[model samples]
Target: MKQKENITLSVKNVSKLYGDGCAYCAETDAVLDKNVCPECRTVHACRDVSFDLHSGEILGIVGESGSGKSTLMKMLYFDQEASRGSYHISDYDTSQSNVFGLSSQAKRQIRNEILGMVYQNPVYGLEMDFSSMSNIAEKLIAAGSRNVGEMTGTGDHFLDKVNIPLNRKFDPPINFSGGMQQRVQIAKALSNYPPVLLLDEVTTGLDLSVQADVLELIKEIQREMGISMVVVSHDLAIIRMLCDRTMVMLNGEVIEAGITDQILEDPQHAYTQQLVYSIL
Candidate 1:
């Protein structure tokens, strides 16, 4: 889609090469000979990738594993820096913010306040040992909210917003079902009220029935919070339900992107069409 000044996240010329191999040549080497191996090969996880994430819009990144969807989300969360190019959040140049270059304090500030990440692995991002309320409150405190009571209050409020009952607030995620844990994670992600929410396959392990509920909760929360989101998932149905725009990626590049309905209804790219068919 076209870039806009209202864009909350702008990634331009962003590329990531894991080792010494160049991005283009690495692909060339993989293609001509399937068995060919390059030493310390540069694995281009993301290729000169560019896209705009507008405010209050849920932009879904759909691709199979190894397709760079996760890597792109990592870059968005400032979990990793682009090997080349830059990402700008709001008016601040993320490139200049030096996702990798920032001081520990600066990076922490960005992470704790500006961006919130929900992972496919529930246990990975949240405090498994803590109660849902405790986990959420901790994040709010770290984000510079000195009012502990207020943070706790907001935490409970968000939990309810995400449909987590007050009775379960003190339960650790370990005892919760996959769906409930996901809800708690979503609550924690929003506790600090970050401007951006990055969800990496947040529905990976749920059954179809559970997935639907979680997806609905996400839509409701997104609508209420009015924060931008990047949802990474291979599930076309989920993406179709949640995103305003959807981007199709393959081997680290965005092959197609447009309004969710447009891409789902009339895909322009062959790969995109293939994905839509697969969904059918």
Candidate 2:
């Protein structure tokens, strides 16, 4: 596959620490547990993470529950602050800025215009009590769109795209099935037509059949929209299906990263080999 010349997003040396930066936390050589500082007890949720996402590429970050994949995604979407790092969106600025340094208002603008996120749980991304149309409208409203007619039309279009029938467009997500709710979340995320989409375990809690359908929907969206995506999931099957490139994370570090097929068929890292074998 040929890639475009420009990079969409670049992340360098990103780390998220839960405690104050004590001197002991800085000089620790504890290889066995990089996340825990034996001297100061600072928990490193993500440590020295770095990657580049090109336009129209789907990059997969795969790890277990505590491997910090979710933490990385949170940082990308501004849900959590990074202790140290630089994040740059090429379309927004040529110079990399610490995304954590941005003001709350600026961050909100970035979230509304530049980035779209779909969380593992629909509750985080959608209002259970709000109608599906209203849920999609919330994003447009946040982006300063006040035209009721336009918002409703856009919501209906996206809901249909996600296979949520027009009748359910007015129904609240609380009354919908898990799969339907997930689709609505996807629709809400794509409603803004953001340049980057961040998906965190979107199919984890769904049934196997439902998972397949959601996966297919995601692929279809990616194909039609050509949006760059960052997908974080514990399921290797999801990563294999959605990602062009894969990053294997363990203990808050990327142990291996490369083409998805290469990572699965010829895993070089011990942890990645274990993961691949376990799945097989």
Candidate 3:
């Protein structure tokens, strides 16, 4: 694996392959091993994906569904392990530190302290029964914020920072509007104050107005927080507005990566050009 110079987060030749084709599979006995591991055919969610994220830089990853966008984001969040290559955050080498393959305590520590994630589906990531404040406070608490008052204060601050109204803090995510819920989720992500942020299809299901607002909020937060960001989105307009650099993925491979303006204005790869043209 080749190293990228002075990068906060770097991924080299990473790949994720899922299972042999099967219609039905039996459940496993262990909690972690719930899915059956087959050895017949394999499907690659991500293939030889490589990229670098410098401190305070926003790198946008664009692709169609099943093109490995979400899978790649999951790997960043340590939700799934990469089958090949390595990733580094700050001085921590993911492959060497047992970062992904770690004890629950170790994994939880790294996840809470170093990384923050804003998922595509807000409802899916959030607790429907808990208030937005509770959802946000949980992550902060896990990340080492002790006092309830402090947690609540920090949660409120983040919610305000993400532009979610304070009045909605006690409301359950299910009760809030889609955009509002997404904002609350963003607040939760920032509550821990992680140096690296991963956003996956956050604005996909939003309306035009909400999308604009959400994108703006993200941009403002990135600038203020000065954290490295990896945003996975299919929306070209959002990418153009928010990203400093862009990577175009096709069929689970990165076809192009360069300055956002250069790729958007004059893409070199045929697939990149096609994707940009289709959206434009």
Winning model by TM-score? 2
201 in model 1: Cα distance from truth in Å?
0.7
lDDT of 2 by residue, 1-280 (tens): 2443468888988988988856765653554355787767778888889999999999999999989999999998899888898998865653367666889888888899889999999999999999999999999999889999999999999999999999878899999999999999999999989999999999988999999999999999999999999999998978999999999998888889999999999999888998899888
Q: What are the per-model numbers of colliding residue pairs?
A: 1, 0, 0
Measured over all alpha carbons after superposition, the RMSD of each candidate to the real structure, in angstroms, is 3.0, 2.1, 6.6
lDDT of 3 by residue, 112-155 (tens): 88888888888667887799999988888888888999998998
lDDT of 1 by residue, 148-179 (tens): 78987898799998788899899899888999
Report the CA-based lDDT of candidate 3 relative to the real structure.
Answer: 0.80
Once model 2 is optimally superposed onto the true structure by TM-score, how far is the C-alpha of residue 131 displaced, in angstroms?
A: 0.2
In order, the Cα lDDT scores of the candidates are 0.82, 0.89, 0.80
**Top model number, lDDT:** 2
Candidate 2 has a TM-score of: 0.95
Q: Rank the candidates by TM-score, best first.
A: 2, 1, 3
Candidate 2: regions farther than 4 A off: 1-5, 28-34, 93-95
lDDT score for candidate 2 against the true structure: 0.89
